[model samples]
Target: MTAVTTDPRTGMTILDEDTCWSLLSSARLARVAIAIAGDIEVFPVNIVVDDRTVVFRTGEGTKLAAAVIAPRVAVEADGADPATGRAWSVVVKGRAERLDRFADIYRAEDLTLPDWTGHPKQWFVRVYGDQIAGRSFETAPT
Candidate 1:
């Protein structure tokens, strides 16, 4: 539980930083959106939460290239609780950097994450969210 903001019209709850980070810590799948070559591209990534940062593994491709270029990116995750008719979404906007430091790389190695692609992912990228926010709302009745 975080900021209990209820919209006067919609009853939407605005989540605070701590609640946002809590949701991120429990979620493993997120979409990373990056702007590259004058276009916006989104990538579905398997991520691990390192405190307030999001970390994922990638190969030398657009995802890696965009991170190296130092562009502001967005990582978003959402969840729905049907029984409670509640749906929530959290977004993290920040810069993505490649984990090149020895300590960072070593620590990342210990973070066991499943690779659905089963490809050789040798690079670790961390997204530092400059702004983080979330909202919770009641789903429309069927």
Candidate 2:
């Protein structure tokens, strides 16, 4: 964790860029939001953070199209600590690009990518942006 910020009123902890990437690198599931036509679509994807980018697999359809065509995109992941009941969320905004080159694909294969979907995910897309922010705070009992 490089830097941390706190809100006096709510006691919320703000996470820095390094911390955000750290959380993202450990997270397996995340939601990728893309803009298509005039609307926005979000999809749950299993991800592996390679360097500073978020990579996920998808089959042909809207998700694939969005990844290829969308000018900008956002990927978000969150987690909660059961012991402390503290929840945190991290968001990454960046350009979505497909891995079409042989070297890139081969490199991606080396990483541990966990996919829950039984269907074939032939296409690999990576999202990377300059903006990333996160926060952690105590959660009330349910």
Candidate 3:
């Protein structure tokens, strides 16, 4: 059975770890946030959950460059059931490592992450989720 938590302050609900993982797996797109030169930036990318880790692909660009400098990153993915007015959001904090080894790259290829752009995305970034949290809320009726 899935557990649900209710907040006393606003009646919002908190999701358990199991529920969070389920939502993460169902999400196809997420925002990868990283700090670059002391400034924070968020980039939207297609992602997949693998072994409890969030994986995505990017090419030689600001996103890759920043991840190289700052290994730690935070990722956020969210979804809502419009009919029910129930929404859930998940956030993961972890270390971002670039996979360069042939074996690692080969394994990542199996993920089959899609790139919306036609450009080739060779660089892969795997975020080892160290801490994860999620929450859900039922909006007031319209």
For each candidate, the alpha-carbon lDDT, in order, equals: 0.87, 0.87, 0.87
User: Could you tell me which 10 consecutive residues in candidate 3 have the lowest summed lDDT?
Assistant: 1-10
lDDT of 2 by residue, 6-74 (tens): 988997999998899999888999999988888999989999999898888888688888888885899
Residue 39, model 1: lDDT of: 85
Angstrom error at residue 32, model 1: 0.1
lDDT of 3 by residue, 11-87 (tens): 67888888888899889899999987789989898888988998999996788988888989999999988888988
Instruction: List residue ranges in candidate 2 displaced over 4 A.
Output: 1-3
Q: State the lDDT at 64 in candidate 1.
A: 89
Clashes of each: 0, 2, 0
TM-score of each: 0.92, 0.94, 0.91
Model 2 root-mean-square deviation:
1.3
- Residue 124's lDDT within candidate 3 is 92
Question: For residues 26-130, what per-residue lDDT tens digits would candidate 1 score against the true structure?
Answer: 788888998877888888888889867888999858888888885689999998889999888999999888999999999988887666578879899988999
Clashing pairs in 2: 94-128, 94-129
The residue pairs in collision within model 3 are none
Kindly report which residue pairs in candidate 1 clash with one another.
none
